[model samples]
Target: MNCPCCSGKSYEECCKPFHTKTKFPQTAEELMRSRFSAFAIPNGEYLMDTTFPAKRKLHNKKDLQEWGEMNDWTKLEIIKTSGKNLVEFKAHYNDENGTTQIHHEISLFEKLNNRWYYVSGKFLD
Candidate 1:
């Protein structure tokens, strides 16, 4: 299947490795894409595992699953990737109420122990 991150690559080639721990994303945007794939695939465990430790507390599996279910993610657009740590993106999806909307945000990332962590995202209007 095609990658949900809209990378124009197969799931196995693009995001599955990240999801399954075979390989980790090398950049903030790559991480963001894998996370987007996680949401679209509803892989709550992967989402939880990838989130920064401090932020993971706010993202329980149940809640992530519920949110993923509520938002049927369709496409992902990387608006901009700045430096090696910040990525801005728009995720197009249909909400639980079936309203199509765009989730626009600028996300912060940091590297610790040579691995990238998702710090936070600032929602955009």
Candidate 2:
């Protein structure tokens, strides 16, 4: 699929490594980019895989598929990220109605076994 970051690259070359069992993102910014790619491809498995086990919600493929089908992501942008293993970002995307929405969040991630997993997020407005 096209790179969700709109960097004119394939998802594999852009952000798949962070989602797959390949490489773990070294920074929060990289993780944020990979998450955007996940939304673009509607890869719920990848999303869940990247999510911290403590924060993972739906474990069933059917539910994941349903969630994936419910949204149409258009764009993503990170406002700022700081601290160790914790990042704050803002993502903008168009919904099914073509309405643009902004999700500002402070995300937490933990590195385990040399892999970073999304722990949780606090939505800010």
What is candidate 2's lDDT per residue for 1-125, written digit by digit as tens?
A: 77886657887887876666678778666776787677666777777777777667636545655555666767776666777677777667676677878878888888877777777789999
**Per-residue C-alpha lDDT of model 1 across residues 1-125, encoded as one tens digit per residue:** 99999999999899999999999989998999999999999898888888898888777888887788779899999999999999999999999889999999999998888778888999999
Cα shift from native, residue 10, model 2 (Å): 4.3
Name the candidate that leads on TM-score.
1
Quote the lDDT for 7 in model 2: 55
Q: Global lDDT for candidate 2? A: 0.72
Tell me which residue pairs clash in candidate 2.
none
lDDT of each: 0.92, 0.72
**Error of model 1, residue 93, in angstroms:** 0.1
Clash numbers, per candidate: 0, 0
